[model samples]
Each structure stands twice: as structure tokens, then as C-alpha cells.
Target: MQAQIENTAGKRLWIKLSAVAVVVALAVGGYMSMSNTHAAPDVSFTNLKGEQVSLKSMRGKVVMVNFWATSCTTCVAEMPQMVQTYNAYKDKGLDYVAVAMSYDQPNYVVNFVQTRSLPFQVTLDTQSKLADAFGDVRLTPTTFVIDKQGNIIKRYVGEPKFAELHALLDKALAT
Candidate 1:
């Protein structure tokens, strides 16, 4: 009855794997749902151009606020993709702001922006007040995707999957 024992063992292993998959799915669902309820803070960004861009004024646009530091490897690695994403969607009502952390030198931020020829607005949070307002964002590459109605719909703590992020932006902008 060796074959019978093997069949039973395989079935038991399959059932265990299926249960683990279900648990993982539920956890991800809960995490995603948790991000949909918070309203975006009424913050203003003064870009390197010395222009004021406010969240309230951008109520009808899908805004991406990226908090990044020049020294963060992950942040540096994701810059090209972020630029691509912004260029691809900027005309489709996507407003992107790259915010330099308070610790990042303004000169370095300016050099990075200039060297990269970044198309989106880049701002500096020199006093960290903007960081404090946006949920005390202390991480180097925290990103918040705010929906058209000024609600923080998605928060990515590290590098986001660009494809998934684009899909979410599509859905948010369609409305």
C-alpha cells in the first residue's frame, strides 16, 4: 500500500499549502484596505522654482508625493522608474512631487535634479514640518499616492512595483 500512503501524504501537503495561501491573501487584503481611509494632509509644497503647490489646490488630480533622500540607495535606484512614471502619466492628470528629506543637503538635491533633468516638481522639506504632517514620514523612500478627492489611497514604504502602481493610477484617474 505504498502508493496509497504517498497519495494521502500528497493530499495533506496540498491542503496545508492552500491554507497558507489563504492566510497570506487575507493579510494582504487587510493591509491594502487600511490605506484607503485616511485623508491627505492639507500641505503645500514650495518647489525649487519657488512656486506654491498645495494639496487642496490639486483636489482634482492624482498626486504622488515621494519623500526621498539623496543618500538612500533604494531611492537612488528608483529614480529612473519614478521619472518614467511621472512623464508617462503627468499629462493624464498625475501630479508628482519629489520631496527631499530635511537631512538631504539642498545643494545635493539641486544637483541631483539638474543632473537628471527631472521633469516633475522637486521640493525640500528643510524644517521637516512637511514630514511631520505626512504621518511623520521618517523613512528615506516613503511614497503616498493620493487620489483625486484628496484621500491617501496607497502608501508604499519602499520601492513600489511600477506596473502595479501604474494600474492603481489608471483606476484612480479613470474616475
Candidate 2:
């Protein structure tokens, strides 16, 4: 009878340890997912005028790095709102950089910008390196709002509502 009780107690202890291990594993996984979701990588590329630009160089200003493609309707749709926002805040230390991905010829981007009258600086990502640098840019109109300290404060992956985008910009500018 004593041996039977000892065996039962050991089984109970094993079950408790297994439950604790499962909880620990779940906790670790949750933390990892949360961290990965927030941590976006820094990217660097040249502007349309052949000026080298990087997240590190815009440390003192709130930078909006927008990834776009000339063929994307949603990307083109957001240009006017972005232009308005940039024009309003440019004097207040808000910098906008639009990186055009998957466009081989700069003329395509230049033509699009000219047709739309986009005033913000535009860049061409010939190799899609900028998109790859900032995690998987699965969508055309991905925007990253970087704080003055160069940390990515917010990320939008689609045609952003102007109000929502402006709210994020205001928050970043306030910081």
C-alpha cells in the first residue's frame, strides 16, 4: 500500500511539473510574438535625386517612410493625403520619404509623381532591398512612422485613413 501511494504521489508531481512547463513555454512564446510584432528593421535607400537617405540620418525628425509601387492603385490613392500631411508638417520637422519598389526605370516613378504633383521626396528601390529590410512588406502601401530617436513608432500596411495617419503623426511629433 505504501509503494502504491508513493507511485501515485510521483505521478501527481510529474503532472504538476508538466503543467508548469507548458505554462512557461506558452508565456515565452507569447513574449516572443509580441516583441517580433513591434520590432521593425531599419532601412536605407537613395532618393529620386540620387541622395542617400537612411533611418539613422533622420534621427532628429519624425520620419515617415512609405513603401509604394507605381502600379498600385491604393498606393497612388494615398499620395494626396500624404502630400497634404507632409506639407502641413514639413516646417515642423516632419520628413516624408516615399520609396517606390519593383520599379526598374526611374522614369516611371518620376512620371507618376509628376502626374500626381507629389511634392515629397520619392526613391526607387530597384532590388526591393528597402521593402525586405523592413520585415515582409506584403502590401503596396506600407508606411512606417519613425520617431525622432529613429525607433519605428507605428506601421500601416494599407491605404491609411487620413485622420488615423495624422493622429499617429501628431503623436510622434508630440514625442
Q: What is candidate 2's lDDT per residue for 1-175, written digit by digit as tens?
A: 9999999999999999999999999999998866553434666777777788777777889888898887888887778888889999898889988888876367888898888888788888788788888885758889988888877777888977888878887887887
Best by lDDT: 1
Clash pairs, model 1 backbone: none
TM-score, predicted candidate 2 vs. hidden true structure = 0.78
Scanning candidate 1 in windows of ten residues, the lowest lDDT window is: 31-40
Stretches > 4 Å off in candidate 2 = 28-32, 35-43, 136-138
Please give the lDDT score at residue 5 for candidate 1: 100
Error of 1 at 99 (Å): 0.6
**What's the TM for model 1?**
0.80
Off by over 4 Å in 1: 1-35
